[model samples]
Target: MRWSNWADTSSVCGIEVAEPAATAEVSALLREASEHGRRVRPIGAGHSFSAVARPVDLAVDLRRLCGVRVIADGGGRVRVGAGIVLGDLNAALAAHGLALPNLGDIDRQRLAGALATGTHGTGGRLHGLASAVTGLTLVTPDGQIHATAPGDGLFEAARISLGALGVVTEVELATVPAFRLRAEEGPEPLDAVLADVDAFVASADHAEFFWFPHTRVASTRRNHRVDDGGGRPLPRWQSHLSDHLLGNRAYELVNRVGAARPGWVPALNRLSAATLGRRTYTDASAQVFCSERSVRFAESEYALPRAAVVPALRDLRAWFDRTRAAVTFPLEVRFLAADDVWLSGAQGRATAYVACHQHVRGGFADVFAAFETIMAAYDGRPHWGKLHTVDAARLAELHPHFEDFLAVRERCDPARVLTNPHLERILGP
Candidate 1:
């Protein structure tokens, strides 16, 4: 069989694949593969952009092991199968008047895929999805099932192991009561926007900005929590027009044009940023946080110290001028609270996430490499699921608990059942 991830950046051929419906079935499959000296890679929905899911021997598909299993702690939390897609998981949570603490803009990822990749949403005081996990059940390569909680020695590593430790079978998430967000979005000058970064981060429950690479304007968002019980969602017609039509289709068409000339990118970006304009609405937190994203692109994102964002972005702008690279996609900037997860990008301090994107047809090497170089000065950590060239030696220097994570991985899967070339490159052989 052949497999490819969502962005089509990574692919693999001639792999054995298995989809086990129950935990016991997974254990048996792992043990069988282990005896044959066949390594196993567990993949969920193929949403990651990186090669973390590229299989070396057997691709253990987990789509069948999905959906909510139990609601506990008086329904404030949910224990769900790892393979449940985020869109479905959100709906399931809504039915119980509960929701995950945060969500990234894209919701097509499976629950396990999101957590393992350290997927995060935007908020100064909020951490990534893995941080919301209070407990988890992992099936080691040796076919042993072990459970972990927040204080457990292995808990930190299990949350965002990047599929290096074991396969996550189930997750116990601490959810918040369903809430609503009042989002005010509009364009602002880049200078004015960056100058008030601290005030902006402190004022909103969630905030983000998108600056078209060649333009001076930025689309700013301030989403504040509102108590008016889950106010009205966007009208279906308006939502369809703005989200599906303009957000995805129109954006795709513009990128197609940008691909051909590349020289016309700056003008096109200004037009898009100017025309996107302003809008305000109140909706369920999930609805407000996530938007449909169908236009495929390769991306590189780095998490930097909160104070370093402005300087890094400034350097990026200078690089663009120096290289005159014409990029059409907006540079997205977001914030997150510190997390204790061993491999989390935001570990140990408040962080700002800056992401750069390029249409599939356009050249991205120079820009991606440039930003990677710029972000490095701030001790940046790459998002595990995104594009990055950092290796284990460099990574070990960035993460505080680097050795501890390796120690855990060594003990859990000493036979190296859950590793591939990519893990070897990034986490060492």
Candidate 2:
């Protein structure tokens, strides 16, 4: 069968797939593969734009291993199956009067994929998704089942191991009580926001902005925790209009036009910026945090020091002005606090994430390459699930615990059964 990632940027053909429903079944499959010396790669929802999850020999699909199990009645801890999609997990948690502290804009990724890739959201005071993990149940390449938690040495590395240490079958996450968010979003002057980006980020519980190239306007969102009851939400019709019609359908048409006429991109982007009118609403945390993303695009994101965000955006804007690159997609900027997870992009330093995207039909090579060059000066850490050219040699310098994580990987998969070309490139052979 053929397997392709959600972005359709990476795909493999004629690979054997195994769908194991139980942990014991997964162990059996891995043991047999280990004895035969056959390579294996576990797959989630294939949401990664990179080739990290591209299976070489055998593909273990974990979709059947889903569903949430509450660790205790009111302990705020849940053991979630690795196969569960984040959206589903969020709903389950909401039903239990609990929630993950933070979440990325899109929630289609499987729990394991999000945790493995160090997925994060925008919040100067919050850490990445992996930080919420208190425990993990992993099946090593040799079929050994190990339950690990903090202080286990392997736990930190395994949290964001890019699926190298082993296959994560289940994750125990520390959750928060169910909450609502009062979201204030609208267009703002890009110059003003960039002039004091730090203050802007610190002003809210969660804040992010998207700047359209060739436009001085920035579409900004600031979400703050709010009382659960007596909150106002966008009417159903208006919500559908904004999320589906303008956000996806019209956005797709605009990209199509830009792809056809590169010279008109500037005007199109200006129009797109103008349509982001002001709106305020209150909703459940998950509903407010995530939006419908039906438009297809390829993206490259980098996490840099919090202080580098303004300078990086300035350089990027200059590049767009100098090269007249016709990109329809807006540049997304977000923030996250420092974390201790060994391979996390935000590890050890407060981070500002800059994500650049291009319509799938548009040319992205030059744009992404130029963006990478600009980020390099800031010592940016590339998101593992996103497109990037950095390799192990440079990665080692970027990550303080790179060698330690490698040691754990070596111990877990001595035969290197869980590695692929992408893994080898980033983690070394």
Predict model 2's lDDT versus the native: 0.92
For candidate 1, the per-residue lDDT at 419 reads 95
| lDDT, candidate 2, 137-210, per-residue tens | 99998788999999987898889979898888999999999999999999999999999998999989999999
Q: Which lDDT tens digits does candidate 1 get at residues 1-429?
A: 999998899998899899898888888888888888998898987877789988988988788878695564445878899989999999998988888878899788988888888999999999899988989888888888888888776788999988888888889988998998998889989998888788878879899999998788989999999997655677899889988988889989899999887889888998889867798889988999988889999899999999999998899888877776878899999999988888999999899999999887787888888889999988999999999999999999999988999999999889998999999999899
Task: Give each model's whole-structure lDDT.
Answer: 0.88, 0.92
Query: What's the residue-level lDDT of 42 in candidate 2?
Result: 90
**Model 1 whole-model lDDT (C-alpha atoms):** 0.88
User: Which 10 successive residues of model 1 have the least lDDT summed?
Assistant: 69-78
Best by TM-score: 2
